[model samples]
Target: MSVLELVEADFRAPTLIASVENTKPPATVVDSAEQLVDQVIKAVGKNIVLGAPLAIGKPISFVNAMYQRAKADPTINLRIETGITLEKPVGKSKIERNFLEPFVAREFDGVPDIDYILDLRAGKVPSNITISEFFFKAGSFMNSPQQQNYTSTNYTHAVRDLLDKGVNVIAQLVAKRTVNDVTTYSLCSNSDLALDLIPEMDKLKAQGMPLAVVGEVNTNMPFMRNHAEVANTEFDFILDGNSKPDHKDYSLFAAPHGSISAEDHLIGLYACSLLKDGGTLQVGIGSLSSALTYSTLVRHQNNRMYNSMLSDLNIYNKFPVCKSVGDSGKFDEGLYGCSELMVDGFMHLYKAGILKREVFEDLTIQTLINKKAISTDVSLATIRALLEHGAINETLTTDDVTYLKRFGIFKPYIKLVDGNIIAQQETASANLSATDTLEWLEKHALGEKLIGGVVIHGAFFIGPKDFYDDLNNLTDDDHRKFCMTSVNYVNDLYDHMLGNQQIKQAQRKHARFVNSGMMVTLDGSVISDALENGQVVSGVGGQYNFVAQSHQMRDSRSIIKIRATTFRNGKLKSNILFNYGHNTIPRQLRDIVITEYGIADLRGKPDHVVYTELIKIADSRFQQQLLADAKAAGKVAKDYQIPKEYANNTPEAIQQFYKKYTDQGLFGPFPFGCSFTDQELKLGKALKTLKAKTATTSGKIKAIANALQGPKLDHNTEILLKRIGLNKPASFEEKITQKLLIAELTK
Candidate 1:
């Protein structure tokens, strides 16, 4: 059958299919295993696709299954795909963690499933997983087939490419969905915008055709505010299956203590700088993203430090970003969110007193829009208002506006003016209530009109009860925001939102970045992929979108940060490796690459100059080697200078800094928020002490002494430690410290 027909069948299926239930493993395995196998599928070939619901460590079992299957059936091909990847926690037990078990197991298990597993850490490759691939999950590997690094940043180019490719079937995992008048699903790219596209199956469908859904199954799906859903029938086929397997208790990693990587921090700082005081910001979770947001928060909270930093950078002349969103971005007016990964970052923004809501109206309701309140079936006026306010400054021209008004925003009635509608009689029925109000606002209130309900429909799985509760109890206004149907329709709406002018601008920027990718170099020689040794650690996520969008935004810029070298197996190497077989962000599109050493100003610069700047940011340990390599390759001139000032910011310094704070007991693992019991905290501290003792060069005794005498270590604790390790005679002070430690552990 054709892809279109298959999609139709899936969307239109009348009966619910049998739901897959997880089988319990042997009791012995269950008791010993912190990580359990959710589903076991048999794949005969090396090339096998293990499909299941969203869960942690699905990758591990999938990999194992593929390897075993491939081993038994040697002729079968092997491939791996997962909805998400997890980070391994430090000093965590296998039984207590999910990622570490998979990782360490994978290492010991070896590459039995050859070919490739789509390394997310490094970005795009065939096989051979690298150590760098464990950073964090970005996007889904299931849709990697549809991911194309397009040259044009324009949404249309993306649309045109997909359309030309004749792709139609768009699969998404959503808690709930709706069928809009349009033929596509309205998937929220962020709070302010959505994408309507079909990537997998699109063939022989007449233009302006009414889309049909197939089979759909509904369960206890979490309903989230600030996001919307789609109808089950919106899909050509919906699988009416019960809930999939559960993968709860997924352990998360603790942030590394003491040594903060400067390169990551620099990138975050630069990105934060790009966000106008009130401009909407979309940041995922990671050291880099966290660093940027934290830096911004710290700057706003600490005026002295903020002033000093700005003065040192001589940015006093630049537009000072109002650390306050209301004062700066006018977020109180409303801000949009566009991101693939919806980390708690948005929550952070909301907690920080940003995240505003705004309502839109049609020209018919233009006057109401002026009043900052519009009750309409359409939202063009609101979008236009946002554009005027510089919230949507993506360069959509008049012609683009015309196109959107005609077909993009999808309003059935263009004749009805918003003002003429009687207060009691409205086109869209709003099932609003005080409960919904309280849930959405959650103490966050804006104007009478809560206009900031965001719609996001993608592969979703609600982990806990409380999380689900928060998502379900949204107001009527919040419900209208969701239009989950097909990925194609969602992407289409996104393009329409972009309109023509933005599309044109995106195209120009796209060509530039793509061409630059082609011209990317190794030793300064052009190479297609910049990834070292052609290894793909991670796939290209929405990097193209953000980069292209930044280029299209006249007032914004894209910044990429990579540490000069990563510490692995105890040694650090140049992050800007001499040659990479794989590349995520190429030099041509390399806008601002920041490292702890310094920033590499690559944009609009020649190869020679760019090479020198990049080398300057190379860590001191590897600067000489990198420059020598570049010079040998004739990428840099013989007299090319590597700034000396950039050197010597060693891990040792970071260690000292952390040690100073930790000795004082100020370098806490939970600096922001933590819910660990006091006993747990004491246990953790005791463990740290034990680890510190073992890590010291003089062995356990010396390390114990150093730790006990550290600034934060109690005065009594020093005597106790001396007694415990037999370094000094036991005394009253020692007795008191011992009692304290014991009490902490018991309590």
Candidate 2:
């Protein structure tokens, strides 16, 4: 069956088909990790081609077992392909090592051994073993030689590339459940890559090639009831045992709360305001997402406060686009979220009632829905549009009735009888007067059918423990609202299949993809995944796809959020560089860029306009240098001057302005929610300050001097030190380090 057919089929009733050979090989049920290893060893030749899903979808027991087997047997050559390997970094320097080793040990105690990552970092990776991932978590492998040599690929093409490179063994974590005396395994978190892989693997197997598709069932894995959930028959091996320990819960990577600056909130306020009601939204995972979510909540729940915040920021006067695109009130129609990672922030939005809009499959119905001409209640105009678009015939047939009911055009009870529409006690002829037909449709609760449209569509999800809990706790109906589909569909605007292209694009309207960039050039070139020096920070995942798609759609926009400046070693540096060595999204694809300073609309703008607009949103301290560089390069007029209002875009100015509102309980760091304790939060901030201080020579000297002075500690300081396990130092070196930490904290 085709992929489209597979998608349309219900998960509860999977169609079993005979193979090309008229017989199918049954999946083996392994009782333990040892048995799984033995099977892998027996199935493998000299070389092992392994593929797994990113992050949480990874089969921990199986992979660790494979790693151990590979280690003991030198003849077993292993090639692993995956993405976003979640491993804690081994600190490179003394200070970094001192802080991170203890911190991680304390923070992630009892976490399962991610042996692969550990081996890779320790240079213990067998000479024959190769690890390749298309996208790495940002800054995870900054100094690793092996990772440095690994070339990056886009998210959409990762599976194809892996397969081409001879990935024959695929293993992923699955959720096992027993129903009707049958045990089934659900892909759970990541069916994004698996959906494409399974079909290809089946084709290859039919051609008589050797392939091992393994599903390691973990009882702890939440059985996500969406496109991701699948039957056990899909795999070649189902590894499960009641006696086996439950899969160790890998705590979801929690983004530090309130990491968002006041400036971030300013940018978020502008971006959130631009989002139209009933439009599609795509957001990434980070502090900026939290900021945007918080701002969106404020806009919907407290319009007066939202407006006041915008007014204080002078958003209307600064960006003319804000006056036109910004919505001042709550979302009656709500928004449809389409994102790569269904981060915890979406849960907050869903709970706030902001992520409530639902879009249908047909273009005609979608158009009417977008224009507010049609909803659950069938209107005369809706009927006319449906007829004009050939969605429904003048004389409603049984086929037409089924189609209408399917797309939410007709109420569930509204049936066609003798060429007439009947809803409970009301009946109207198909050829009746428009007014009478409208009255009949409106009298019944026909709109209820479309009320619970998909709130969010994600490819895969990985967030805080609370995020998983939220998903698990949702009612079946609410859970169904969070659809997990393939990255191919989520990342791209059009599908390769001709039939689904138009349908996919129409579903995603008013597309606002909010992504973050480390640095953006004056001419609108975005550098996100890597630095100018060719050091990889994060791999370019789906930013390019979203940006390109934004330009393709008429009303769509890709808003790139960036901080105006970053503090490095206690010195402020501009993120708006004149030029960068690498570009993820080129100047041609640039749509909208936002910084804490302001918003810059660069879409369809000329070189000079782009340069000026970008500079307008840059830190005031760096604007002159950028302007000078642009002028020297003949990109900007020599007479161009920095605007008077934008001159106040200094860090000090932003901090002061942000403090006023923050004091008033707005624009907080952890505005949505934070996982950290109050004490941990305070200590984290202090430790971060100390780390930054240690990076500079003068700061180090100051720290040493403070250590020599040995300042007396108060009750709060002593308690804080004990909380971080530094109150009573065991060694002289530790005692000195403790004194330095105390000095830094007190300072």
Candidate 3:
């Protein structure tokens, strides 16, 4: 099918069943890896087109088994299409190979390994097997052969392109559990492509095309219901080896909450201030998202604290935009969430009742909604406004009457006939002049029932174990509130074929697509997915699509949050570059560039204005260099100067400001929620400090010398050292390093 047709096709919820009835069941349960390889060899034949979901949904056992089969048989021509294959890159340099490698291994102990990624990086990928991906997890494939030959495509189009290439085999990790004495399966982590692919595969099978759908059942995969849950009948085969004691837990990619630097909170605070009460929001992963969620909570639950923070930061005075755009009060109207990945932050917002805003399908109705002229509780005044705005005709037709009734504008018992309104044993003029008709409509309208709109719409989700647990524990009704659809629908501004009148933009109003970037240039161009040196950091995921959509909406914005600076090899570096060779969201598409220092409103701004605003938000240490470059390029006047108010935009100032808040119990690293304990948090910080010290030769020597000096250790310090496996070392070098680490932690 064409991309448009595929998108326009109505999606039907898969039937939830206890067991497979009509379809053939699995012929055999493969208990061993060798057996899995043999099964794949038989099922795949000589040439095969294999498709798998991205990230956590990838069936590692199946993929590795296929890899083994491909290695043994060069005649097996296999094409694999997937995205976001997570792999840890073995470092190349001394610092990376020595310090960083061991640090990561110690930090992330249980994370699974994707053999294909390692093979691709080592340039040992079999010539017979081809690996293709649409979007990658940030920096997962940078400077590797896989990235050099990466297939660049939008998230929405990726599925279409893969299917067009004749993807006849589908494999995904699934959650299996017994329901009413029957084993049922759920697509737990990812339903992004599976929702579309499953239905399409059914059609292909009916057309007599060779096809195979395999579900690798892992009990560790949280069994979630919602729209993702489906019966085993959906798949032709089920790999149920997870019940074995030896089966390992699918490596949960835990993005441990990063420390929320003062700058991060400031950027988050500004972003939160721009959000409207009843608007639509789109936020991605990371500490910045967590900060924004926390700020939003403060705005809703603790107005006094929120307002005080804003005042302490001099937000309204420092940035005039906050005066008009910032909202210090609570969100009575709440918000709607539409994001590519529904991160844990949204859950916090939802729990706080800040994500309860509902939107309807009709554009005319949505416009009325924006103006606050209409609501679920329809009244005479609302009907009059609709008529006045030309949304409805004076002489209402049957279709108009139906539309009005559907949206609660007209009461269910009321009827329109020949320019007249008819009620129970009463009649009035259809011009809305009759008081009785108005009162009847208001009294009988379906008030909040009509407010059944989706709270959060996401393409896919993956987070801490608690996030999965929360999803699994949601009530059936509450679960439906978090809809899982394809990226094509969630990321785009308008799905022309969504409903009637395909011409108009079809999206919730006041959309704020908040994304993260590595660096932003003086001209407001964003560098997110790659480096200026032509190395891919992350693939261009859904950032561009959302940014484009933000411009298309009337009261929408594309908010790109970037740290003002970053530490590289023990040295601080500015993230606001004078110029960059590559661009993710170009200068033309730039909207609101937010840094810890301030917000740079670039949407439709002149080049000079853009430069000035960007410079104001840049790290104070690099502000002069950036200004000089802008001046040389003739984008800023030679005599122009940055305001003195922004001169305190230094790391020291940020640290001091953050310390004040920390005393008041604000700006915690994991603001919204955390899975770590207090001790772990402390230990993590100490480890980070030690890692930094080990980055340089002189620092390492100093650290070793300090260890030799023999600082006394407390019981708690010894316990902490044991927790990180540093209490006793096996080798002489390890013993020295352990002492150094113990000293660092104790200090």
Candidate 4:
């Protein structure tokens, strides 16, 4: 039997709400994905505009069932509008398949595939079904039709776009918690956009448009508190079988830490130097983010080593902007995380005691904290500042007492009635404006510390399995420090209705929004998400939003890190080009750019200054050509020559620098952790070499000839071959492949 058929008895679809419940109505529970899909179709009609969160929060079981139903019946027009539809990596060649398939199976055991993605990959997605994504998993869908339907909007604008696209249904994978017979759901990994989208959907429903919200409780998912926690009635329908026999419990998808190259470590070191203490931080995923996380830990946990490396590397003398814009001291005051994507690196930061700066939502408390007049611990000074800031009146009203008590500025035992402050109706102050009331308030009103303060305000979270475990293991107090909020709060300084603009500015002081770009032009513009000829390597997810936010904030700096050089199609190429056909971020928003060589301060600079500074941090091999191009374009002085210090900014120079610190036990390739073993690591390198050779005909021919001339393989070679199942060399092709692989592995 097919996996999707309902295991429970037949039941009719329940009526979905057309308006938001004034008081939450009980959700109708379902037993199977097929039954859920049937209810969704009945409630929302044939034209189902389904909205799902990006990444891990998607309920794939429901998604696949819906897609199958749509496929089976062409009359059902189903549109899956979301981002980052994660598909397991498929090998491009027979040899690559042998090298990677086993690893994929081991890593992604029991993970169900999205039926639409499988069909889309096979180029057989039915015309009735449309999959529109705002983002892709970076270079995962370069040439697919995903580029055509890519929603070109900022993260904050996703709700607006979804509304315009007529999204009538929202489905998510949620985590359920039970307390005293009461059950509630937490959005968990994806409170990001949905927190904002739900209110808009309610507005739509109020206008009599039919809509449904469905949730599938995934026991594997961690139940997050704060804004991610929602009442059970928020869902129109629910699927809450935690441990039924029919339920297929699969391993939650994991993003194992990738290998961070030596150059990437240097880039991270430079980038981390720009993050100030007690500031806000924003970082994305992958090796660079992991490198930054590792370096940040080094700065916090081992400041002596971090400082020594910086001074030895001549960072302050060479890139003085780091000292000016950021600092090289321990994060004694700590940092607050306000990011769109809460990657695994953030967990590393949190574990190292680096992510500890807590920001309160109360504008009065936050403003005072930002001004250094008060701390998270409420004091006499806090009351004084609140009075001075005109946030409160000397004559405390019942409203003022309630307001103060909400933030724990007032003790829990205290209450106000008829313009008098009382503690359990026994201790009373009749006149709050009197001089005696000041001392009375200080003695009775103050609490130990600020309540409801959060260290990390994230829109969504995606990481490895262990990362989730770390979250699940956090103490309730520690967990409360993290608030899984909406993109409006984390991604931008707009949304004044929520006091976001004013409060966020007070919270996010000296923010360093670190992101990655594929390339930067000589003029300082960056090409991050797309390639030339309009093929998007990835969608402009939240990079543009953060860049714009950086520009809007006085102290916040947008830091875009590039690897300086990339070996694409088996040839080394500069990521800092003279010009690029596409630009994700234009020159006007140009801020700080970092490469392995050094940091380039491009904010508020002339065109010549921007290009000149950028060239100094570029790879040495490409500097001359870039300089010549700038001269040809008249963007820089015609006679300007490369600086002697920067002229040696080659890969060999980086290697020497890397060697200097190797003995000091720093800059490991996989800084966080890795999925591969020692032998597998060696085999991974060999596979890369094989891939590079196989990229071009001439390269492949040369590789084959070198394999023919090379010495015969020994027992050591057999071990590597056996891992990829080429130990026996069953065919002529297999024999040639083994020889080629052996040549690379032994080298």
Candidate 5:
């Protein structure tokens, strides 16, 4: 929608006004975190059940102050409920620490540490302070003291869970903007739970329960418009970082991008192909998302290159699903994103003009657009469609006039009052059934087009610093296109507040919800969140929700991407196993699985067919063993033979095929851009290799001993050595580490 239309559409309905009047925010401002903490204690009491947003949207200083106050007074029982605690990496070994400490300080200079999370990591959280989360930062909290305090719930259910836990205080980070003495706030990085939680909290407060909805304002946060915007009155205690010293603005915690391997790139290509043009898209973080994003852009902007790669890989011939359900063609209609996490990928797509499929909030308009019965242009046909759909009556009411004006169906001067239609100079009958009245309205009242259409609807965002900057730099009009909303609205088709089932179905046509999984059993169960031991690798954040949602949305498909094989204890093993002890997605939910080698369409397939299809994409080295295991378990037919054409599903083969593009200066490690310096990148690769080679004690000693007698360091080696603080050996331990680095560099 045009930026101006967003303003025009802001006119609240009289019906909704009464319903939301009592639940509006207090809009009181506080000077500092300590002051806010004082207010919180007074409002909710010392037994503070604090609710915080996950990831970078957390207010670090405010949370720290709350924790410190609670710690200083054991009587104050503080329990923090949040997820994805982003802690700066601290290496385990001396050499690693030396390398990482300096690097971390440089990369994360202004990012404040979460004091309680740090203490929780050290197993030093006070007895009265309990920290818990429904999501983890992948493997971050596996061995932490609070690992047992995990909450297993879908993203859509977090608000319900938080309310049940009697969360009395909601401390959220927000972006503030003031215009002509009127100030407003944007949920910015996170609108996920708060959009659903705040109203419920207000209801509790109305019932005389002590509760506070606090906002910690940060100017560094991008002030996204549309759904993300909230009135200053919505927050009871706002620490305005813009004008307050105690709540001074700090740097956003940037989640740096990692290298996208060739395998991941291929997987992305396969997955994005299934993403139909003009459909809905949702993806998560990591190299796979980057790869998929890079390739999808290539497919849209440089179709020749993308098509050539697809043809060279013979994707259409081998994976029949790619031909039948997907296409190598460019996205002519673009896509709309509805994801829980708005990863940097969406930004890339948005910039490249691929994320431009606008969806509207009004069910009639959205359905008409979806059915191709009416376009965004509000012509005579749009009026006809609305009349036919019973969206408006022949005799216009005040509500009819408001609705028509809100959607820009009528010109600004056109108005309905006291039973008459005012059209500039001439008055007409309110009844559009009168031929002359309809003609006069169409000639002077109808507007040019629709407004308030948003291309992306996401719950939260976390990405590299560049992506954040781009978001902050967006023009007000462009910013409105990205609607940061609630997880329930973004991740489910069942949400009723935004629209009904028909409207949602129309908006999400041909949806492709792509997600990454760790493993897939031959029976088609997907293992993503944890291992066979039931240890939590990461929370099942929103993958399951989108996957399940795809089944309910029309013409939608759930594509699960997995690396064909992975290194477990330095041993290569097929990720597509015969069976797994745990599963996040059961066999019945299986649809499509993508790997570097191939795509496996598991939808509605029998056990034998599913087994063979999975085996077809498994690493060639383990295919025989996997097939045998499947046969032994009777999952596959005893007489089933591996297809000769698909027998060359090896990593080397995958690498060699991708080398064709990488050699041509395409498909680089960091497809979008690299965060690491050239020198840091070199050292990081060498360090990882050394760490792997020295996994055994004997191997480490032998390598160090060999390095002691090695030749002098070359100029490049010296430069890299200096980068990681090993240019000179200052101690006995440093001397040993220096030798190890020299050996790895030389090798």
Candidate 6:
């Protein structure tokens, strides 16, 4: 049960080695790609010890490849360690013209080890030969008992069963981030084995088991720097590849649109009111997280102004803002980040001169990272520049300075000249005292800082490049200090140093942490099950962990912000329908529900009030329909109408507000960095639409032509036309006509 015991349990096993004669990636990986099919068939025929994690974009490719291999080698047993099976819709929504027929049903109908097929219609896993997992989202997550015990129990049994049956190698395609920590997993750098838990690796290694761990490298994924990393040498064979998954695009999914909602604003507003100028902050990703961060930034920038005027002025009652709060408007101590999703917002906070706040670690060395001693090659320079530019204060104490130096943070009094460290003369120990350290740090702190408490550690696509870069660059001692799971699991060990004032404040500073997006409602119960008609818009991720954690933490609230409506058939409809065929967070657990219209404080509200708020945010066009349904169900009165005040503040009105501001050049699209050309914008929209459309060959080709020959008739247009399935016309007139069509489209 203890991590130490787990490590000791499986420390040794026989090493399974497979030398790949060909290391090059297949040039043309298709459903009928012969080379890959041949390789897989050969492995199956030989009854390879394990089946590697298979990632393929085209569902048919996976089905065909697996089907062929299984047919050729009946005796060869197959096991799938990772990845998910794509499920088509059973019933049609307005979005789908017809009920989508199952595509891979034929391949899986009688396969012995096909495991389980996740039926999207039913939230629960159906009884099947293989395990059926309805939701399989990839991310850097925290490991709770559910993950460490329940999830691991199934896996351990499966692996043990295989081993007993004489299967030697268990090839699994785990998220690259889940392996041993680069910060912690570095000690075994020279060892040719990859492991999930230390005890397993140690046990198998000790038994002289021929264990071969494959490092499934997804190079295109966003790499993050954390107290975890896996050395390249640990994996016997590194299978480098990429996958085209239907992941949440941050640009389209940012605050107020995707995950962020109005309820987040309410909670964030409450949290900001509680936070003192120097307090720390931690938030998960999504609309609510974004709302909290964005609201905090606005407060700091606008000189302690309130964004929305709610009834409670609990601001003063919560935190004691200093007399000179405005001058030190920024979250001076910089809020530390503590949430599972270390998203773009966290990075933005740091870049905005707020992330330089103190990090509190249980370990002394990690205190250095808290003090920013172990500097990021990119963040270090950026933080230093901000300090010099008056964006942040440069008043770190000698203890802070010393720890930073010990941890390799080059700031304040030190400068790294051509890779050599140098101490600044003005910041020498001879000139400082302990009192000055506290005063200086507090006085010179930024507006906000975010320190996160992540549950799941690694996955494809969510980490930063700098995080991986730093882990790879760390020295052995540094790596040992940084990578230890004990150090990284700060939340787990928060109780160890409860008396510490900083840690206590850090715990309290948290406002809210959310579960992942989209909850289905079934018989008035809310659940997060894509299998139950809820398309897994985003994975469960670290939602349950942080939400539960926030509930336990003092002065903190657990908030769930959901769109009042979901986008279906090119229209937004009430997400809270008569029957939420899918439920994520049930009504009992639902504390807060937000829509663009307003917040539904449903925590203890009666069924009547809950109905009121839910319907308030529903689009006016659909509000009457929802009301009729609710009334028919006896949840509300037949005469119940959404208060006119609520109706007055609809999304149409919200859009109007933006349009007015846009006319005055106040807001429209990218208010910050991005520059969009008309052609580019149109192309982007076309691509987005195409992605949402039901995939058909004719539809796909038409989309391609519209994107290429229908954007602009410039030189680039000519190139695009040739690149797509379009053939060149013989006459100049035909070309001119095609170009005219493109010109019209662009206009």
Model 1 per-residue lDDT tens digits across residues 669-707:
433344344433445566444444345345545544543
lDDT of 4: 0.83
- Residue range 33-77, candidate 5, lDDT tens digits: 888889888878998999999998898878999999988999999
Q: What is the TM-score of each candidate against the true structure?
A: 0.52, 0.88, 0.80, 0.94, 0.94, 0.52
Per-residue CA lDDT of candidate 6, range 413-435, in tens? 45334422334333222222345
lDDT of model 1 at position 140: 27
Estimate, for each residue in 308-350, the C-alpha lDDT of model 3 and write its tens digit.
Answer: 8788878877777766655678999998998889888888888
Q: Quantify how close model 6 is to the true structure by its C-alpha RMSD in Å.
A: 14.1
Q: For each predicted model, how many residue pairs clash, with residues at least 3 apart or on different chains?
A: 90, 3, 1, 0, 2, 87
- The TM-score between candidate 6 and the true structure equals 0.52
Among all windows of 10 consecutive residues in model 2, the one with the lowest summed lDDT is 11-20
True lDDT of residue 521, candidate 5: 91
Candidate 2 per-residue C-alpha lDDT over 588-689 given as tens digits, one digit per residue, 9 for 90 to 100: 888789998889999989999999999998988888999999999999999999889888888787888788888888877776566567776677787787
Clashing pairs in 3: 139-537
TM-score of 5: 0.94
Q: For each candidate in the order shown, give its overall lDDT on alpha carbons.
A: 0.36, 0.76, 0.73, 0.83, 0.83, 0.39
